[model samples]
Every structure is written in structure tokens, then in C-alpha cells.
Target: MKKALTFLGTMVLTLAIGVTIGQVSQADTPSAPGSADDPIVTKSYVDQKLAGVGSGGNTGGAPTGGSTTDASFKVVTLNPGQTLKGGEGAEFILRGGTATAIASTNGGVSDVTGADDLAQGANVELNHLLLTPRNDGRGLKVGSSTAYVLVRGSYTVQ
Candidate 1:
């Protein structure tokens, strides 16, 4: 009886050790870096800037980072086909060449301010939002005053 018990204890220890080693090795291993075929490494800006409307004291600096949780932004010009969600303090910037404005949230209704820009060949800045996901209002629009809305800017994505 003692011999059988000894054998069983040894087997359990061996299994435990094996499982530990296997898990450790599996975690340490890395996937083969993909090349041309396997798949290589994968890899916003605000629409408007509100000037001094003459407010009292300065507001909290939280909105600048975007949503408290990890968020992303989709940017497109001449068409409203993007969504904007921000990280903590995620600020977005874009260059729409003057007539670059987006209509977000409200669809084609056009209710938000800074959604339409009359500026051309220039850059516009929009302050990040606090609630309601991101700072996008309806869809950005490119007026007839301009031909193409060139885009340039950065937003946190995680």
C-alpha cells in the first residue's frame, strides 16, 4: 500500500511540474513575425476652435484627453464617414483647407457648432468632449467654396 501511495505522489508532482513548465514556455514564445505574406506589423483632430466667448474661470482640463476609457477616432474629408472616441485628454486636430467641417452625432440634421468651417487652406482645432463618447457632431462638411478637404492630425487609440 505504501509503495502505491509513493508512486501516486510522485506522479502528481511530475504532472504539476510539467504543467508549470509548459505554461511558462508557452507564454515566453512569440508568434513568427509576419513578412510580406503572413501579415506585417499592423499599425483627428477637432473641427473647430471656440475663441473667447468671455467666460468666468477656467474649466476642468479633463475633456482635452477624450474619454476616460480607451477610445478611437475615424477621420474622413468631404464625407461624413468617421467616428471619434478619445482617450483621457486625447486632443484631435485636422487641416481641411478651409471648407472642412464634420456633422457628427445628429447625422445630416446639422445641430452642432463648429461642424461647418468657412476657412480654406487652413487648420481648425476643436476641443475634446467630456461626455457622449467624443467631440464629433453630425458629419463634417466641405462647402462648395473649396474643392478638396486635405486632412492632417493625431488622436489616441487604444
Candidate 2:
């Protein structure tokens, strides 16, 4: 009985070691570098400088432009071939010059294939509940233009 127990213990240890090695090897494999064909990498800006908004701070240590509101503007723009996700608890407005947005949630109202095309001067606001999943919003892709502008809405991080 003791010898049988010893064999079982050894077997378990061997199996564990094998799995660890397999996982290590799998993780060590290098993925190809990101490219145009890969997923889009969107960038975020804290101010609306791209849209020609004046810098809102004092340059020479004196407050400028009277009393300014305490509103913070966050903008996220997608590159030509990239995609962006409005995180689970994020709210943002989608403004596009010429692009397509795909909404897929609640069993696919509009999947990626069913794109919501947008013309110049078009915008869509997406408001998500805090309890909702991050994938509830749409995936945006700029058709022929450079990128799509996203005006972030106010959201408190829980």
C-alpha cells in the first residue's frame, strides 16, 4: 500500500511539471509585431486641441480667460484601420467624418458585419450603465478618412 501511494504521488508531480513546461513553452513563443493588418491602436487626448480649442491654463502664472468651468475633456481617436472599445464603464460620443461603427451586444443587434455607416459631421453618443459589460458598445472603423473622433463623457470610476 505504501509503494502504491508513492507511485501515485510521483505521477502527480510528473504531471504537474509537464503542464508547467508546456505552458512556459507556449508563452515563450513570440507573437508577430503589430502592423496595419493587426488590430487598431487608438490614442487618447485629455484636451480638445485637435478641434482648435485654446489651451485652458495660465502660461505666465496668471489665470486667463475669466472663470472657466471645471469640465475635463477626454478624446479618443481611431486610426484608419484600427478599432477602439469604450471600456465597460465608459461613456463617449462617436463623431465621424467618414467611417463605420459596429455594435454587438445583447445577442447582436448590430454585429461587426452590420456596420452603422457615418457621413461627415455625424455623431452618436453611447451611454453605458456601470453594471454593463465593456463589450456592450460598438467597434468603430474609419472607412476612407484618417480617424474617427470620440468625445468622452463624464464617468466616475467605481
Candidate 3:
């Protein structure tokens, strides 16, 4: 009878110790950064980072009213004869008006949406996502009217 009681007490003690260890390990485990349990930064910090983007030059276009989670596209208006030069990896989508591709000696703009390459003087397709492969003056030249374009990444108007 004594051995049975001792065995029961040992089992209870082991169970209690196992539970305590489990709880301790869970408490010590840190939540992943940028997760729901632990955010990487505050809302203000994210806002400040967003504000710094597209600060220089003519940022006259508003964000496209779409279901995008972030403001990645900047709408830009270009006058006739003006060129929208893109830096490396710059993305462009001609929203309105007419424009032509301005290719450098290296190559031309990549029309990802159309799955084609636009050489210099090629007409830019409206609503197509164009990507500049290099920073060597590859972009779009506005036609004889005001052109509206959605630009993402580094670019300049000249």
C-alpha cells in the first residue's frame, strides 16, 4: 500500500513538473517580428517612411484609386515634348494620352503586360506595365497632349 501511494505521488510530481516546464518554455519563446503578436514598428514610423518616398521633383499625381494595400504607384502628368525618364528598375503604366518609348543604346523598355520589348520611338501601350531595365535614359516621351502615367520607383521628368 505504501509503495502504491509513493508511486502515485511520484507520477503527480512528474506531471506537475512537466506542465511547469512547458509553460516556462512557451513564455520564453519570443513572437516573430512584424507578426500580429509583435509588430516591427509603430504606425507613425511606417507613415514617415512612406512620406519620404517620391519626395523630390514633380510628384503631382494622386494615388490610383484601386484595391492596393500600399501607395506604390505615383500618378504623373507630362506635357507635350516632355520625357519621363526612368531609373533602373523603374515601372511605368501610361494611364492617359499618348507616349513613345525612349530607349538607350543598351536596349528599350520592357512591356511586361504586353510581353514585348519597346524600342526607341515605339508607342507605349496604355495600361501596360512597362519596366526600365537600366538607368540609361530609358523612359517615355509624351505626345502632343498631356499624358498621365503611373510611375513606380525612381524617375525624372525632362
Candidate 4:
């Protein structure tokens, strides 16, 4: 008799939980305008709701505003045994000429010749550097120094 009573109690609790879950899910569903039969689960409905959320700073989980500096590139040359120097926040590219030394906090050094020896076409961000060309090579040396030519590049300091 006790075993039969326990089984009956378990069955009743399971049925009650199932019914509660059904009612809660129905309550959470958004109803359609002028109609109770339709639940608003379409993508268009969700997008419309998000579109009206915010503006200027953060809207619908997206950053709506930012600041950027103008882009510019300067043409500078480095001579053999000469050194170019740059400080923190400086950015540049080796557009023309070769280098013996590309010393910076990022790029270690390249004491060679030709375009492949220089960091061409790509931006090189500097923390601090003292670039110098190899003595035997005909290319220029770039580093963070007042004596050498400055190959200042344009970038957004963000």
C-alpha cells in the first residue's frame, strides 16, 4: 500500500510541473496586434525593437560614434651610416630606399640591402627607436636620432 501511494504522489507532482511550464512559456510570448493567436517571434519584429533603443554612443549593442585622425605619408630618405629616430606614438613606412638597421621596440634589426631589407608598404609603430643603415651597404639607416632623416608616416593614434 505504501509503494502504491508513493507512485501516485510522484505522478501528480510531475503533471503539475508540466502544466506550470506550459503556462509560463505562453505568458512570456509577445502577442500580435489585434490578435491573440499570433506570437511575435519574427526577425523583423526583433530588429524593429532594437532600432529604437539608443543613439550617438551605443545603439542596439553597437558603438555609434568614434574619432579618427587624417591619413598622410611623408617621403624621406636615409643615407648610409645615417640614422633615423622616432619616439613613442610615431608611425612610419619605408616607402623608398633601403636600410641597414630598422631598430625599434617592435622590429629588432635588419642590416641588409634592397627593398626586401626595409619595412615597405606597411606601417611600423614605434615606442622608441634608433634606426641606422649598415656601413658596408649603400642604403640609409633609420632610427630614433636627430642626426638622421625622419621617415614619419601617417596613422590614427588610437
Give the whole-model CA lDDT for all candidates, comma-separated.
Answer: 0.39, 0.46, 0.90, 0.44
Which portions of model 1 miss their true places by more than 4 Å? 35-39, 43-158
Model 2, C-alpha of 39: deviation from truth (Å):
66
Q: Which run of 10 residues does model 4 get worst, by summed lDDT?
A: 149-158
Residue 3's lDDT in candidate 2: 100
- Using TM-score as the measure, name the better of candidate 3 and candidate 4: 3
lDDT of 1 by residue, 47-142 (tens): 222333234334442245444432344454433333333322333443443333333443322212355322222223343121222444422333
Write the candidate numbers in order of decreasing lDDT.
Answer: 3, 2, 4, 1
- Which residue runs does candidate 4 get wrong by more than 4 Å? 1-72, 78-81, 102-158
> Cα lDDT for residue 63, model 1?
44
In model 3, the runs with Cα more than 4 Å from the true position are 1-71
lDDT of 3 by residue, 21-135 (tens): 9999999999999997789888888898788777854364544554322238899999999999998788999999999999999998999998999999999989999999889
Which should have the higher lDDT, number 3 or number 4?
3
Model 2 lDDT on a 0 to 1 scale: 0.46
Q: Per-residue lDDT for 57-147 in model 2, tens only?
A: 5444444767432234365566565555444434344455444444554522222222433332233333311111354554454555555
**TM-scores for all predictions:** 0.23, 0.31, 0.56, 0.26
Please tell me which predicted candidate would have the highest lDDT against the true structure: 3
